[model samples]
Target: MSLAEHVSQRAEKKESSMTQQTQDTTTADLAAGFAAGLDPREVAEAVLSRIAEREPVLNAFYLHDPDQVRADAAASAARWAAGTQRSKYDGVPVTVKENIPRAGHPVPSGTALANPPIAQSNAPVTDRLLEAGMVILGSTTMPDWGMLSSGVSSLHGISRNAWNPALTTGGSSAGAGAAAAAGYGPLHVGTDIGGSIRLPGTWAGLATLKPSAGLVPLHAPYLGRAAGPLSRTVAGAADLMSVIARPDARDYSTRPYPQMDWTKILSSPRGLRVGLQLHAGPGAAVDPEVAAAVQSAAEMFSAAGATVVSVAPFLTQEVLTGIDAFWRTRSWADYKALDEEARGSLLPYIARWCTGGKDYDGAATIQNYQRFGQLQQATREATEGFDLVLSPVAPMAAFGAEDPMPSNDPDTPMTHISFTLPYNMSGQPAATINCGFTSDGRTIGLQVAGRVGADDDVLAACAWYESVRGDAAPDWSRVP
Candidate 1:
């Protein structure tokens, strides 16, 4: 046969397979329905309808194009009808973090310094989602350069928590967490260097994964940055993992090991060793309700036949502060590079963060990294005998949406997120699952972290917890 004929035949075969498949817009349900011959357009319409109702109040999306959604859905529908569906998540509505590029959308990195320019191509994770047949919903919001732990961004404005409009959505994955909690759809993407994913997951009452560095590839790689899914269900997040964790040539940090079936690992975590560590170190105070929720989840693990024990904090306050110092030093350099006008336009909190490391030299920066390594080594050694460590996802609950951090006190912000950042420095997988809520009804999260390359195990424990705990959340729009 001619080369052209062979190519054409392959294309026809692909189209033939497109001829195939949810409540709360779960990607799994949508994909299953599409495979069973359901029209993708209906799913698209439902998602769009939900967005129309929720966007004004939630501010979860920075860029949502209904026309694009419709067009993609139509194509997916045709493919399914033709039995040419690409992957399991095909036609499922998925949102990406704005910092991660999407074709034709501007990624301003949630900063005034970002001069908007349409991207020529998608980020690696974005490409993976598209390849699997997932419909692109829109890009979600973040804090400026993902600086703050709260959702207050100077560029896109505040992204309010879905549970309570008056409360802040923990960030810099603010929009992803809020959207997941709000039932915007079943799958959303979030990035974490510090506690961006888990903090929002904790505050918004959703499940988020900060997969071990390189477990999920990025378009541009960095030391402490990793990205993963934010979902209402652990299974939904696992589904996203199966797609987005595909290896990318751009990231060399990804493990050389074969990919594991995350969905299969969601079995009960019986016989696993779990540790409860309330704080990263002393002097970091955790709210009573938050501590109680984490303790409650540990008890649940014990009930499931796992050996649960309390371990002294492996990280010191200096080590905890070192992680933030590492970030600030980089930000300080970036601040120095910015022209006068751009510097003037930066958000006040971010400006403060940038200047926080101004007095430190490169030698000080290197010392911070050295301290970071020591902490990572110590943490791994301490948890070596355990399968997972259980802790409060945040030291505090969601506060007012307008506040820069938990309070006006500059020192308190890091304390609010102390438990989650050490793992980031360690380059280990960590996740936050809703364990309970505070007295005022704000959500609390129980964090689960595993050794590097144990992303599957960490997620499995969370999924198991979700099964017993039940993935119940208040519908934000329905409230009041």
Candidate 2:
């Protein structure tokens, strides 16, 4: 398929059943409810109530205006009553990641910057969601400079896991994960440059699709960054995609594609070639429990008639380190742009991580940037013959909520991302589904990645898995 082409597409249970969970109202349900005369105010009230009850526990949103949410929802309810709702899913409450610009909202990027610049306009995805009438509950928080895979944010504090407050929410997309698990709303939009979306999605036991890079226009599009949806259901994420995955002149990265039926993409995986990747190659060894959970998930796919082949790691330690160098250099430049106060107030770990690159010459930056293409080539070569690939989302289990990363070593903080970083570089569509839970009660995410630009195909296969996975919706509350 071409970059602008359209294609069609088509989990297991976890231990320690999460009981006493808040009810999740999917975007589809919210739309149906509105169509059937349900008031948007009801959704606003319920969501606000949930946030009011859990925000202190999770620290999900960096800027949530309940009054504005209620008022917009009331306006949506008025539209529904007048038979003029903006779109099918109008009035569905959703949250934007702190990094994604929302008009009048600060784009902190999870830094403790004393005064971050306010965005003058909405990002492409945010604009699309607003045009479709989705109510913006607020911006979800993330770790400093959006550089960590854990939720120890310097600005909004820690975004605790809903499954266990002591555990990390595995981020860059941290608060979105917490809010989704806490049932704040059905739809959320987050960015994924290196597992930011899928890691958090998996840790929070949510369904997330990191679509082909450039498929969704970003306000500040980068090499591997893609704005994606994190929702309680694959359908909900797809629904959000239907709106956000549109052309935007602001994003030179965007390709021209016709609007997709989104629903038609959820097809079966009965005759697909699936590569089963056990290890992420260069990072921490895959946790035994996580591997087992993924193994079982692969078996489920095999039973569904996919040709599940075992695949070897394509990433090397050199490439991993090189990529980390690129990130550090990039972050260091940003770090240098800020005032001394902002720089000093950054999370200590992040500050140190960026400082490591302060002396990097242009040669070092170019060499590190070249590793992106090297890894991309390796990933493309590894999965060339497969229609999709299944793997663990991260190498290790959930770590402490306050730790900057699972390794907790600023000098070497990217091992867990080895599994997820590849897809971002390759520009492939990868989704994370709840396969099972770890012994410590953390959720295990089974990653499903399809050919680049074949988002519909992979999502369809995921939809198929969701249908047969026999598990109830992920246990969102504590397992008592």
Candidate 3:
């Protein structure tokens, strides 16, 4: 039988469990409630209360305006009452990563830069969410400059994992994942250049998509940064994607595609080709449990009639060289732009990274771009036959909350993010779906990536995995 058929049978056997625990304001659950005459104000209040009760532990929000949120919720409630709801997201609460601009909000991007100017306009992603009527709950946290994969942000302190406060919540979309895991609300916007979205999503037991670069237009100064959703359910991510991926003239990088119903893409997984990629490169070492979880995900896909094959590492030296030379160095140039006083205010490690970017001269920058082109082409050739690629989101599990990166890595601080950065270099679509948990209860994410402009296919593959892999949802009762 097909995967959809199996899901139907499973659904029949397992009666829908909308327990009180499951009522933690997921996108789908909130939408259904709003459609059924639920009061948007009440939903907003519950979310605010949860944030207030949990903020001390999670540190999920950098800034949240409760009064503004209530006003928006009141407007949304009025719209639903008049039978004029904007969309399925009309009353659903959502969080935006701190780096992404929202009108009248502070865009700290997790830094101690003194009294930064407030945003006077909405980012395209934020505009789209507001247009679709998603109630903005607040802004989530991220590492300073979004450079690290761990949750140590000097500006916001450290964001603790919802699963375990002692462990780090992987970043730079740190608070988005923590908020989702902590049951703050359903839909959240997260930016991923490297593994920001996927790493945090997995570590916090949430579903996330690093949509194709140019899939969701972003305001980042460099390439490879894309804004996408983090949610507890694949359906929620799909719904948010449909809204935010809409074309915007402001974002020159956005690749325009005809509006498609992304939700319908998950119907079947038969006759699909899936490649299982374990190691990112020679030096990258994956945790045994993470590899096992990904392996199990591959087996589930194969059982669902998809052709699953183990693939060799395709991230070549050229690709690695390009990403390191162009992306990271160029990113540090922004910090390099800051005055010495502002730079001194930055976290010491962030200042170190910025200082390192000074070594790349003009000739090297141009050469890196050329190498970037070659790497993109090579990545295209590498996975030509596969509809999707399956891999581990991070090489290791969540480490200490205060640590910048993993503890054992002596040579490079970026090893944990190795698996997820190649897609950024190639500008392809990738996602992290929670596959299982570690013995210590850290969530494990299995990545699904597809060719550039094949975001729907990637989302479909994730939806398929979630369907077949029963128990994809986190236990909200355990949330902080």
Q: Model 3 scores what on Cα lDDT?
A: 0.78
Whose lDDT is greatest here?
A: 2
lDDT of 1 by residue, 1-480 (tens): 211222234334432122110324456556656665666776677667767777899899888899999999999888877878898667888899999998777888888665776788888999998998889889999988888887888887899988788999888998887788777668999999878899988898888899887888897788778999998778888888888887788787777756676866555667888888986684458988888888888988898888998988877777767767877888888888988898887888788777887867888888887877887788778788889999998888898998878765554447666677778778888998889888888888888999888888788888888878853343444532
Ranking by TM-score: 2, 1, 3
Runs of candidate 3 exceeding 4 Å displacement: 1-25, 265-268, 407-411, 471-473
What are the per-residue Cα lDDT tens digits for candidate 3 across 1-480? 222223233324322222222335456656666776766776677677777777899898898889989999999999999999999679778899988898887887888888876998889888888888888988899988788777777788899898888988889999998888777777889998778899888788778899887778776535667889998888778888988887778888777765656866665667989888888783458989889988988888888788988888766655565556665576677876888888788777766655666678888888877865675676677778899889998877788898877743322456576678778868888888889878777888988989878787788778877877876445667765
List the RMSD of every prediction in angstroms: 7.0, 6.7, 5.2
Instruction: Indicate whether candidate 2 or candidate 3 has the larger TM-score.
Output: 2
**Local distance difference test, candidate 1:** 0.79
- Return the number of clashes found in candidate 2: 11
Ranking by lDDT: 2, 1, 3
lDDT of 2 by residue, 1-480 (tens): 110111010012111111111244566666766776666776677678778878888898999999999999999999988989999878888999988998887897887777788999989988998899989999999898789988888887889988889989889999998888788888888899899999997788889999998899999989999999898788878888888888899999998655556787544567889999998778898889989988988998898788999999999999999989888988888888877877789988988998888777999889989999999999999999999899999877778898888887888888888889999999999998888887667788889998877887777777777777765247653521
Give Cα-based local distance difference scores for all models: 0.79, 0.83, 0.78
TM-score of each: 0.91, 0.93, 0.91
